[model samples]
Target chain A: MRTLVGNHGWATIAAPGNTGNVADFLVCRLIGSIFICFSAILSGCHAPLSANNSSRVEITYWRTLTGAAGEGQEELVRRFNNSQNEIHVHCEFQGSYSDLAAKLFTAAAAGAGPDVTQLGTFEILQFARAGLLVDLKPYFAGPEAINTKDWPGTISTAGEVEDGLYWLPFNVTVPVLYYNEDAFNAAGLLGPPTTWDDFYLYARKLTVRDDNGVVREAGVALWNITWPLISAIWSEGGKLTTRDYGHITLDDPVVLKVMTEFQTLVREGAALLPDEASGGHRAAFKNGRAAMILDSPAAFQEIFAQAIGFTPMVAAYPAGKNGKVYAPGGGGLVLWAKNPATNRAAAWRFLRFMLSAESLAYYSQQTGYAAFTESAQQVMTNDLKDSRFGVIHDGLRFVRGDFSINMSPSVRNAFDEAFQKIMVDLADVKTTLMEADAKAEHAIAERGI
Target chain B: MTRTSLKACGIRRRPRCIASQWRSNRSEWLTFGAFVAPNLVLFVTFTYWPIVYSLHLSFLEWDLIEPSAVWAGLGNYARILNNPQVWRVASNTLIYAASVVIVAQFLAFFLALLLNLKLRGQTIFRTLAFTPYIATTAAAALVWVLLLDSKLGPFSFIFARLGVEGPQWLARSGLALVAIILVGIWREIAFATVFFVAGLQGLPPECYEAAALDGATRRTMLWRLTVPLMSPVIFFLNVSGFIAAIKMFDIVAIMTKGGPVYPASSTYVYHLYKLAFRDFEAGAASAFAVLFLMVILVATIAQFRAGQKWVHYE
Candidate 1:
């Protein structure tokens, strides 16, 4: 089974063949090929024992990052491989996040998915429901585990399914406010908005109309704006999903109020809804066409490179009247196999290697991603001093990615749609959200994980 | 009897000729069966059986995870009817299909006619026009994404300079379908142009000469003579283009992922994909697929009926 798990599904040997008479020259070549090859072979009857079986056990790991992050994961695996001869781990780049999930679900259905694949914190519930994941509760409960106290509470929350630990939070993120310093200075504004009311006030203050009354320079425009609205709703004490993760909670007035206020902002010309029909949110920001946009800390690199004539400053989201805040976030988490007799041993071994302090530092340093372990994080704390890192954890404080992996894409789609409708004036706040809520509930009820 | 039986009465024979006719009939049956056996087997194995299986499976509810599908009767179809997204998907499919067919086919026809003319570097011109068609949709959409990309894309950059704020091409709902339509047209134009060119080449030369003798202008000749002559081929192209456009998946999949909204830029096939893979609604997807097949069937029938008056082989 371990050998099977480590095969990586390469099946090139199964070529269909027909045995026919060989040409005379080919037969001579074949005979010659055998003798020539044999000359270089060591004259040992038994296979040379390079390393004994007991020296190391191999585990196959599937991850979904490419380029630098991919290389980081690869380096981590290499370090793990080199650390000791007791365990050899291989890392395979499955695909991007959505692509990985699709491939995973498809393969699990086909009974050929990998043994210790990386899963999102929220996806654990869905996979667990489908019996696609091996339960990690027993692994953590067993004597061979480290203390869970070092892990952040919020980061670990999404990884649990019905009080059972499912996966580790890998790269969690929250939507920090990224504003143009030059734009703010030009508008004669003091600083980033620290409250929702202040956000509206600054957006109004930031608006500059030309002589002809057509505004040449506008205030803050939200890019990738849906998650921020969700954050606002959460700050107002609303949830996007229920505690059980069975149905969506979009119809709640707190959520609707957030959407309605956003609509009013569009009406007042504080924010420009970039024509989604054209492309998406990032385009609006990168062109220096907008003063401010809300995006993830992971986006710090891209925004810095893309934005021109302006330095983007990262800030915490506005604190609502309730002193509440929300985070727009998620992370890839590791999970162990349930089959303790076979994959569990391999999974635990692999997990330990992957989450090692030195390994995590190498991974974090390479990708600019946060580590799941406190020890791993401590090693890279000096490098985390950028202004962008300050508001991120607070932004991720209320980040929710739980939608029962089965209903997530669909439910999130509904929420995204509702947000679009709100911005585009196609559907108003109350009706659109209600419609979305109904659709999301129907999707959830109809398609259980 | 049916129309064939009535036509058979046109043959005249005596009673004694009946025995000889029976012997001929037996030979004809053997030869006909032998000739059709291979095709019949293929049709049954590939086309008919799968269709039957799809129909059977459509009435059952199951995700890909399940070992066997559980029967759901009309439940899947009922759910689709109730869901607002399904209606949106159907409408979107119609808009996408109709727009692609009309726009692509018109452009193809005109371009093909132009290419058919005896011109300098006609092969080069044809190749230049056709390169986009042979290119994979994924590659084409990617290039289009970069070109039309609102942020760093060149098309958007140019568009900005022109004072036209181009929306995010693949992200927003208002113009997503149009973006998809544009990509679909680009992907299809080459094939249409090639097919149209073939149709033009196959035209009888005498009609044009006759028109010339009658002092018909080139425009008049094209409208009165060439266009009518190419009706049969045009009809075939239209039907095929219509079908292909209706079933378009690759362009939509690569370009939009049927997003920003549920019904805004979605199509039936895209809906089917979501239902089956994303939502784990295989039974509903299959049922929707059946409805989609019905649509195509009806369209084909309508096309055949409409073709009789307009499609002139001569």
Candidate 2:
């Protein structure tokens, strides 16, 4: 007989020993199912703890590397895991660099941050100042420390902050000229320009126009943003700031000359500034809308990946009156300050393994960033001598880090505002720069070291 | 004699029946509690706890990197009040919210009226109008970015074809805000339209019939009979729309990134984001959040107070 159990929706069958066999069979099946489910759940609950007891420490490493660069990092981690049995490093892709910064902030705030994270050169300073980063001095002094002298000076010294070394250099890239070979050929330009004057002339020549005087295709995409303008300033023997990074020097005559030259391209309808909301300047070159663009070496893989009917070409940044002086741009691995002693030791081991010559060489081949160590250079030569990445390696000799002070971000924002005023709003260049300089100075003072 | 004996037996059973009923209710309540406990726990943990914690954090100065927090009485609040950039951001937020509410609501109401006309394929038009409302804001904003791109964008390209050089939509300073407002209106109008349509459908037909009998024109009938009845819906939409506009983030983040830096298109939330995430000024960010909550509360209260003047339930 079926009996209702209280006012709840549950019911039970209270069958006697003499009841039908069908009811007994049903009851037996229900009990068997419940037993199986309970056993499965109990086993699942204990599985992880058992696994954890036997294994070495597993540390989380967050890096903001995507596409080919992400794959390279994954490969590096795989190699590291295979090389030893003591520590297993689980690497996670953390979106764009900006996204990585935001997530890292939240994660660190919650005290559940990754053991190691890749940080941009500028971010290294920001984090180090906030005391978020662990000083790698102890690691550098320890037995696992790689020979610092063997690494490229441009990349190795970029992550240095005061007396503390907070980052180990990984992928290194510099802005170089990426040109559409098909567009260059169609414009009857045999090779890339070597100087600023030729650069503009080639830009004009490469420009295609419709009957209505509308530019059907731009000659080049020259934006007024930090990197392109900085490259131009460096080429013109001008610096964005003083050597000590204590003052703004954007109003320098050499810098003004480069600024005027770029603005003139926009004015003459030969070059167009890609809207930052839309895909950046790189997008224009990729879509065949422009013949040339100034882009970072890190973009080489993406450019090749997106190339449809034509192979793109890379050239060293054009020289100015002084010479070629391109700024290196890429991120490096930085350890979070909070970690247990054993995890710290394992993290240092993982970091050292990832920063080796073989790893850098492998990473360089997978992504197009230049190998930034002497030993990696030998490995890359043996591995990728005739590859498309040769241009990146050639561009490396000219590269160095930008002026990155503690307040670099604020200073950069100030300059960027002035840049928009001059380029997008068509304001007077010198006046805007002067005003922006005051703002930058004010910001630096307000945000004081 | 038999009927009186039966009545006596019924009286004897009544107390036992009542006891059984009480026991049944207790078990039902326990079952209900068991079912709701999981969701209630989650809601309190994730939602209620964060709000309370943030309120607490508002009074403390701590960067996430620092191991501990220091109590800062009114320091964060004072800084927010004194900073001129905060004022500019407030102005931007006000302008954005006002424009979106006014433009989007009016457009949605008009579209609702149009769709209300007894016409062919009304459902299709209604569906098309509501599509953007259901579409993810981030994805739509990304598409809008491409459409309004200054150079080589189809919108600019089409304008050029018509012999007009389109203004740099997002590249220029103030113009970027305008583009964002346009996109906000585009995304939100469908929501307003759906509500307006529902209100329109629920309206009493006798009022319109009486006005028509009195030889009232379409415009007059609409203003006199329809609008007064629709006031409650309009009021509901306005209050909620104002809140949504004030809280807008995805579009601004995706489209402008608070840029053209000279005339930065930073909203209040965007400013707070830069403070907390970019600068690691958690205390200041929390303070801003508290202030924003107060602002929203005041605005909502004021809206409700003002609604008494015009909102007609009938």
Candidate 3:
């Protein structure tokens, strides 16, 4: 006789005279199935090793650009791969800068990360200090050595920390004044403001009000982010931080003066401070709701595309009393130090290809990012003739790429809160700045940054 | 041996009887182990291990990329407690959770009552009411952003018709928090309503009829008969809703980003996220996680204790 027992469609046959043997068989089968499932799931976590069966060295390159710029980066990699048979590069798109940094940190902690990654200015210092990035000085003398002199001094040297060059500028940007020419024409203004004083006056003149005195068109819209505000502060002869990151000088008299003027602009209804959710300052400028905005040239493509019915134009940021000293913004490529020597060499070759003059020029033409190399700039002679791109390049002459205090998260958070209080809440500038300085100092001391 | 004879010789027969029982039940135990092994492994690997590791990390000074962690003891906790912004964040979290739970629960209960009535197009009403809950949160937040824009939003149009300007919903500190809370309530009401509808449907009609014979009005019947009978669902919703509200991050992240000013609309979890990811303060973030866990555990325990008096478990 045979007996069948089942639960949830799982069944086992039991011999009438030998039930114990049947039970053992059922148990063993069940356990074996579980192990099989577990093995399959774990196996799926990673790709089969070198499944391509090629002798070429495989390297992974993680990038943080999207849309047209992302496509440009992909094309550059494709060209590099086609140019060489010994190296096969797989380029992956990691989401935004912060997202890439987070993934890199986790991957590094686990002893696994991409061979090369595009790192932002904020991450280079921390990652370098932690000894996660490769020192490229050794690779500078190889057959694929890049001409460092062709790259801008400030930008190339910005990556140098503790006698090690860990980063190379890939995409560079600078803040420029974006304005509506029609609004300027209506206000009887010619060209962009040349001085901060003239800029304030132009803002007031360009502002339009309805019969009930409601502002229909704001004269200027402040980006309200730390990057653009750096220019205004520096133009006023203020320093956000010392070169060594030891002191946060946010409460200096020059900073107070600059911040006070910004507060006055917002308080007097000449400026609009739109938050990120309300499309930010870019959207305000694009929609013609605001006549002027200070933004990075990286926004040129999006702003122009969206600013329909208006002749959008770009100009150099207004000069302060001390003249034009602007901060350089954007990200750079850094090779991870954890890779094997062969992989590292291949990654270096890929980096050299990306930073080549032709590649840089092509990238800049495709994206609004400024070509940082002199050779790349020379290659793009005709593209630079456009006033919008030319104005962005003009700001590059006085770009300061030092690791300032704003690079520290604690200090940046403190300053951002202070800025919001002064600009949005109409708080007293002096007191707010002083409080922020103290808070930042305390946090810096505690964090030991 | 016969059962009476075995009982008389209990000590001698006990071992043989136990051996026979084990022989019969061994397969069942093995099968149970086989079924449970996979889930147990997963839970231990993913959930329990992370909790344990986070607790360990809370005592160290590490930036996450460093090869080794330095001993910090309670330094992370001390810094968190000393920071002034932390208190504001905690207050914001409390206000958000309380507002969402109280407002959403009441609105959900009211809608459930209306929907419980045999009204026309009830299925459509139920589906419409629950749509927001199923809709993607990030997408919904983007829509809310446009609807609340001070200059071009629909609300702005209405305010303009009344000879007034619409308040800057996301640009002002107080209004920003209110806007986030409103979105939270909107999404949460749908989930609570579905649960409430189910509970209402399952309620016994005999209780209400008995109350009516006892000269109870509809209001009294609802209060005395229905509420007690539905206490188990109510208890579940309250506990779960509060927990969900306290961890609210997506709407705040997408809509306000804890901004217009720092900590203006930031919640506890968002603050913790910034510390870990943005600030690179892994130890401090871990400490925050541990503290958050403790708070949740204590709050849940307190709720369960209080529920003994009100929750009906028939």
lDDT, each prediction = 0.69, 0.79, 0.85
**Which is the leading candidate under TM-score?**
3
Q: Rank the candidates by DockQ, best first.
A: 3, 2, 1
- Lowest lDDT 10-mer window, candidate 2 chain B? B26-35
**Candidate 1 per-residue lDDT over residues A246-289, each given as its tens digit:** 65678888888777777777677677665443334455666676
Candidate 2 per-residue lDDT over residues A287-314, each given as its tens digit: 8778888878788878878966676888
lDDT of 1 by residue, B1-314 (tens): 65566569775444377677666455444445544655786799899997887788789987665556688999988988987778888888888878878888889889998898899999999999999988887888777767766656777667567665546666567777888888888867888888889888988888889889999999999899888988887888789988998888876776677765555777778778877776656677788889999999999999999999898876
Candidate 1 chain A, poorest ten consecutive residues by summed lDDT: A14-23
Clashing pairs in 3: none
Give the alpha carbon lDDT tens digit for every residue of B89-178 in model 3: 999999999999999999999999988889899999999999999999999999999999999899999988877767989998878999
Ranking by TM-score: 3, 2, 1
Please provide, for model 3 over A67-167, each residue's C-alpha lDDT reduced to its tens digit, 9 standing for 90 to 100: 77789899999999889788888889989898888888888777778888898887777788888999998888777789978665376777887799898
TM-score of chain B of each: 0.84, 0.87, 0.90
Each predicted complex: what DockQ? 0.13, 0.28, 0.57
Q: Which candidate do you rate higher for TM-score, 2 or 3? A: 3
User: Model 2: DockQ against the native?
Assistant: 0.28
What is the fraction of true interface contacts found in candidate 1? 0.14
The candidates, ranked best first by lDDT, are: 3, 2, 1
Question: Each candidate: RMSD to true structure?
Answer: 10.0, 7.0, 3.3
